[model samples]
Target: MNPIDTLNLDFRALSTFLAVLDEGSVSRAAVRLGVTQSAVSHTLERLRQALGDPLFVKSGRGIVPTRYALQAGPHVRQILDDLQSLSAGPPFSPATAEFTFTIAANDYQRDLLLPGLVKTLRREAPGISLQVIPSGIPSAEMLRKDACDLIVSPHAPEATDIMQRGLMADRNVVFYDPDYRKPPENLADFLKSDHISLVFGTGERPSFEISLNARGLTRRNVVTVSNFSGLPEFLRGTDMLATAPQLMSKHLLRDFAWVPLPFELKPFTLLMLWHRRNQNDPAHKWLRNQVNAVAAAMNKLNP
Candidate 1:
């Protein structure tokens, strides 16, 4: 058969074709589309004439799509989805939105910030859902591929497709148990004190220790842990000092005393990252607003 001009095709014929393929019969397709069976048959006939192929073939008790229809199913579905997105105008109402919002976050940021987000979701977005997944350097790929709605980390993504904004920044300080250790007031005291070293991701040494090692600085690492939350448990009632961001240390300040580090270290900034595709989505906008509000509250207390 010769190729027909697609410009002459009516858009309704595509919808009708999909409806028949889904329902498997003109009668059922008519009911599903709230149209008369004759109207459905007429639409199918027009599709057959335009495409020059029988989209479906009758079987024993139902219809089966031809190879052409089977191949076109995915493209048709994508077109339909794009059209629906373009025409979608419902206002994003968080209170009534029953959606699962997934995010990629490491244990440190997850523990520190998500609890507050969960509380806010419960109070303001009663029907919303949350899922927190472990994150790494490749989290930017996950965002671009739509694996998660957002990612939070101290490190920013290198991918240009991913956009990140600083949620908060904090300085590093020494936290030590008062019962067994005095706050390090000078460089000599800091180097002599036993310390807890935290190792995360692919780094051989933590950033604070890395900066120290660059200038021939060193500290006695008596204990090593992968997570920041465990520092309090390991250092409680002991003289070991651990370096942590000021924001992280705030929660443990009651159990441990934090004093300014003797050496200068760059302040770490926590960032929230998302794909550019979601920048204008109303639902995503609302979700960002909610998270920003939570961060603002945290900033107030830490400040």
Candidate 2:
């Protein structure tokens, strides 16, 4: 398109483009924008003419964005964000503003970090609600798909669209019930006992287990559970030891004793990850700050 044509293009068409991309259908975009299907179609036509591309094309049963559309989306979202900030309203008040925030957390981190976060939110941001989903391996695609507002986990996602900050670093520890057995004093004792392993994903090994295997060492994994919360049940009344992050202290109240792992293992760093789209959102920023503060306090206690 010519400079004149570009200048004449309605900025509203970008909103239509974004809505259509987000909703994946013209009719849905119209509903989200409180407009008619014809209006959305008209906007798309104008955008196709101005931008010299189909922008969106019919797929099997729905429309898929063209390469150009996908490429332009982040910039378009940022443009709209800048415009909204230009006409910014009164400062954000969490106490009065109601929002449903979603986060992806591993069971251990969820148990460790969320209690403090929820406590603060209840007293301060009473109107806000939190939704927590299980965190497997966090990915950039997960963020782009709006899978969660933030991800709290040890593995950093390798997507350019996602940004992350280190929350804490944790080492492995042996957890065992005193009634059933004592803490392992060395690697030989640790290897002799049966073990419970927390498997975050199917067919995947835990870091501590992998580390042990790297040194030609292996333990008898008698019980395998998906989350740290389930470790106690499997370890109780048995001579099984579970090696997990130190953060488990915040979540576990069972009559369990813990000691540092007898074998050398690398520590894992927990991270807070979010999409760039929500990076500048005031409410998102505030929530991130609050969570970061919570992480800092927890790190001090655990570290």
Best by TM-score: 2
Candidate 1 regions off by >4 Å? 1-89
Q: Residues 39-145, candidate 2, lDDT per residue (tens digit)?
A: 99988887887778899999999999999999988888888778766655778898898989999997778888888899989999999999999878777656767
Q: Output the TM-score of candidate 1.
A: 0.69
Worst lDDT run of 10 residues, candidate 1, spans 1-10
Residue 109's lDDT within candidate 2 is: 81
lDDT of candidate 1 at residue 260, scale 0 to 100: 88
True-structure lDDT of candidate 1: 0.79
Q: After superposition, how far is residue 70 of candidate 1 from its true place, in Å?
A: 38
Which lDDT value does model 1 have at 107?
72
Report the alpha-carbon TM-score of model 2 versus the true structure: 0.73
Error of 2 at 137 (Å): 1.3
Can you tell me which runs of candidate 2 are displaced by over 4 Å? 1-84, 87-89
Q: Estimate each model's TM-score.
A: 0.69, 0.73
